[model samples]
Target: MNIKELPFEHVTVKALDIFNGYEISFVIENQTFHFLIGKSEELLPLNIKHYFKNQEHCNICQKMIFPTPFGQQPCLPLQKDMKDLLSHLRKTYVVLT
Candidate 1:
């Protein structure tokens, strides 16, 4: 399925497995949808307007750091709508929960 065609307004990372890939859940008009993104597909460059912050937690330093993108990060600037959606998701699902 094309990620761009997804009708979700908000999305959260439910789970991430190295073997199984990403388990993403999203909400659209109060309805929630769940889908799995394969490992190979997960690394693909997404055709979305979003800044690719390839930041990961540093175990030793305990700080968020941007990693070198080895063809694994999306490189684009986020549009207003995408930013709004991300903000909503962060506020409702990530920060709150």
Candidate 2:
């Protein structure tokens, strides 16, 4: 689906606090997703269809997140959110270019 088809809110013009950590969530139009920029909670309107892109890792979780298929990672189920996000990001960006 096109990025437009996937409803989202542009929560940031540019990420404000990477020091707190960053997470991009994907959600269905009628569902909910949780996004944590720092200690505060940001409720997203859509259900997370995925989680990470560009091989960016979670400093807290220390998981190999985003930009999958880049490294020979084992691909664990615990990181499903990350996996889904990576896939969606790849698809979206590849088409945009």
Give lDDT per model, in order: 0.40, 0.37
Alpha-carbon shift of residue 91 in model 2 (angstroms): 2.8
- CA shift of 2, model 1, Å: 11
Native-referenced Cα lDDT, model 2: 0.37
TM-score of 1: 0.31
TM-score of each: 0.31, 0.28
What are the per-residue Cα lDDT tens digits for candidate 1 across 40-83?
63332122311224555432223444544432222222222344
Query: What is every candidate's alpha-carbon RMSD to the true fold?
Result: 14.9, 13.9
lDDT of 2 by residue, 1-97 (tens): 2333445443322233545344443333322233332323632212222244456444333565545344324323323454444445545632211
Off by over 4 Å in 2: 1-21, 35-81, 93-97
Q: What number of backbone clashes does candidate 2 have, counting pairs of residues 3 or more apart or in separate chains? A: 12
- Residue 81 of model 2, lDDT score: 55
